[model samples]
Target: MNWVVFAIFAYIFLALQKGFGSLISLPEAFGGMAPSLLLIFGVYICLSARAYLALWAMLALGILTDLITTTNPSATIIGPASLGYLLAGFTIIQMRGLVFKESVFTLAILTFSAGVFAGLTTICFFKMRSFSWLTNDPIEGWDSATQMYRYFMMVLYTTVLSFPIGALLYRLSPLFRFHEKKSY
Candidate 1:
C-alpha cells in the first residue's frame, strides 16, 4: 500500500468536500448539510483496494480539514469532527468483513448509518460554536431547540440524498496523478 499516493488524493477529496459543501448551498441555507460523500469517500478509501494506504490517507485528510475549513486557525469544530472520523474509521474498519458482499441493502444501510454518524458529528461541532447553547431562559431554550431541530432535519435530508451520490461516486475509477501540494 503506497501511503503517499493515498495521501495526495485524500487531501484533494477533503478540499473538494469542504469547498463543494459550502458552494452548493440551497436557498434554505443548507450549510448545515454535508453531502455524505466525504464519509463515504473515507469509507471507500479505507475499504478500497488498499486499506492501509487509505487509512493513512484519511488521517491526512482529517488534518487538512482542521487546517482549512473554518476561519479559526485552531478550529474548535474540527476537534469533535476529527474525533468522530477517527472513531468511525476505527469502528468501520474493525467491522470490515461486510465489504466482501456489496449488496444494495448493505450499501444503503452503511451509507445511511455512516452518513448519520458523520452528520451528527458535524452538527455537534458547529452547534458548539454558538450563543444558542448558553441561554438559560425557557422561551429562548425552546427557540433554540426549534433551530437545532431544523438543522438536524436538513442534515438528515442531505444525508439521504448523499446515499445515491456516494454510491455513484464510488463506482467511478480514480485516476491517480501527481499534483503539487501548495504550501500555506
Candidate 2:
C-alpha cells in the first residue's frame, strides 16, 4: 500500500466527515446518527489491502476517529477507538477470504459488522474508564443502553451510505496500488 496516497485520502475524508457530518446526520430525535466517511474508507482498505498493511491503515483511521470524536464535549480520549479499530480490522482481515472482495454488498455488510464491533468496543472502553476513581465525568450521563442504541443506529446509517461510497472507492482502487506487488 502506498502510505502517501492513503494519507491524502484520509485527510480529505476526515475533513469532510468533520466539516459536513452534522449536515447529513439524522435529527436529534433519532439519536442523530451520521454515516462515517472514514469508516467507509477503512472498510475499503480492509477489503483490498494485505493483512499487515490493512492493520496499520485501520489503526490510522482509528486514531483519526479518536481525534475527531468525543463522548464528552470537554474531554477527548484516544485509546478506545484505536484499539477497537484494530480489533475490527483484525477480524475483517481474518474473514476477508470468505467473501468476494469486489462486491459492494460485501463492503456494506462488512462495514456494518465492523462498525458494530468497533462501536461496541469503543463504548465498552469508555464505560470502563468512567468507572475509574479519577474520572469526574461519566460520558455526559448517558447510559450504556442509550449509547449502544445510538451507535447501532449510526452503523446502520453508515451501512446504507456505504453502497455509493464503496462503489466509488472500488472504482478508485487502482490508485491505491494494492495490487502492484501481486502483478509480478
Candidate 3:
C-alpha cells in the first residue's frame, strides 16, 4: 500500500479544510466540521492491508483530525471523531472494488449513511448520549432537522468532491495501481 500518498492527501485535505474553517464561518448546523476525503481514499488505496493495521492507522488519522479540528484539545470530541472516521473507513472497506466503478447512486447511498453516523457521533460526543443534549448554547440554538440536514449536506459535498478529485489524483500519478491484490 502507498502510505506516502495516504499521508500526503491527508495533510493537504486537513490543511485546506482547517484554513477554510478559519477564514469563514461554517453554518450553525454544520459547525466545527471538515471534509475528510483522505480517510476514504486511504481505505480505497489500502484495501489489501491487514485489517488490524488498517484499523490502527485510521484511528490515528482520526485522532490527528480531532487535534486539528479544535485548539481546546477535548478528549471527548477527539475520541468520537476518531471513532466516526474509523467506522466510515472500515465500513467502506467492504465496498472496495465496487466503489471505483464511477456510479453516482452508490456514492449517494454511501455518503448518506456515513453522514448520518458521523453526525450522530459528534452530536453524542458534544451532547449527552442523545442529540437532545446538544440544546445548550451554540448547538442548543439548532433544531434537529437542521442538524441532520447540515450533516447530510456536508458529507454529500465531500463524497461528490472526492470522486472526481480521487479520480484525477489517481490519473495524474502513475503510482496508483488498479490491479486487485491476488495473493497475500
Candidate 4:
C-alpha cells in the first residue's frame, strides 16, 4: 500500500465528512441523519486492501474522526470512534473472504452492519466512560432508545448512499488494487 496516496485519500475523506456532511441532514424527528463518509470509505478500504493496511488506516482515520468531532467541554476522552472503527474494520476483514467484495449487495450489507456496530460501540464506550472513576456525571441527553433509533436511521442512510459510492469505488479498484502484477 502506498502511504502517500492513502494519506491524501484520508485527508480528502475527512474534509468531505466535515465540510459536506453537515450541509446534508435529515429532520430531528428522524434522528437528523448525518452520513459518515469516513466510515463508508473505511469500509471500502477494508474490503479492498490487506488486513494490516486496513487495520492501520482504519485506526488512524477513526482517531482523526474522534478528534475532529469532539465537542465536549467536560472531558477529553476520545476512544469511542476509534474503537468503533476498529471493530468495524475487524468485522469486515473477518467476513471479506465469505462475500463478493465487488457486489453492491455485499457492500450495502457490510456497510450497514459496520455502521450499526460502530454506532453501538461508540454508545457503549461513552456509557462506560460516564460511569468510570473519573466522571461524576453521565453523558447529557443520553437516551438509549433515541440513540438506537438514530443509529438505525444513520445506518440505513449510510447503506443507501453506499450503493453509488461503492459502485464508483468498485470501478476504480484498479488504481488502489493491492495485489502485485506479474509479467508472463
Q: State the lDDT at 45 in candidate 4.
A: 87
Taking all chains together, the TM-score of candidate 2 against the true structure is: 0.93
Task: Using lDDT, give the best candidate's number.
Answer: 2
Pick the winner on lDDT between candidates 2 and 4.
2
Question: Candidate 4 at residue 35, lDDT?
Answer: 79
Which candidate number maximizes TM-score? 2
Candidate 1: tens digits of C-alpha lDDT, residues 45-91: 54544445445555555555555545344323446556556555665
Model 2, range 23-142, lDDT digits (tens) per residue? 999888778877788888998999999899999999999999999997777877888888888998998998899999999999999999999989999988888766767565566687
Q: What order do you get sorting by TM-score, best first?
A: 2, 4, 3, 1
Q: Where does candidate 2 stray beyond 4 Å?
A: 132-137, 182-184
TM-score of each: 0.57, 0.93, 0.64, 0.89
Across 92-175, the per-residue lDDT of candidate 4 in tens digits comes to 999999999878788889999899888899877776656658675676777667878887888888889899888877887776
Q: What local distance difference test score does each model get?
A: 0.52, 0.89, 0.57, 0.82
Candidate 4's TM-score reads 0.89
TM-score of 1: 0.57
Candidate 2, residue 84: how far the Cα is off, in Å: 1.1
Residue 41, candidate 3: alpha-carbon lDDT: 49
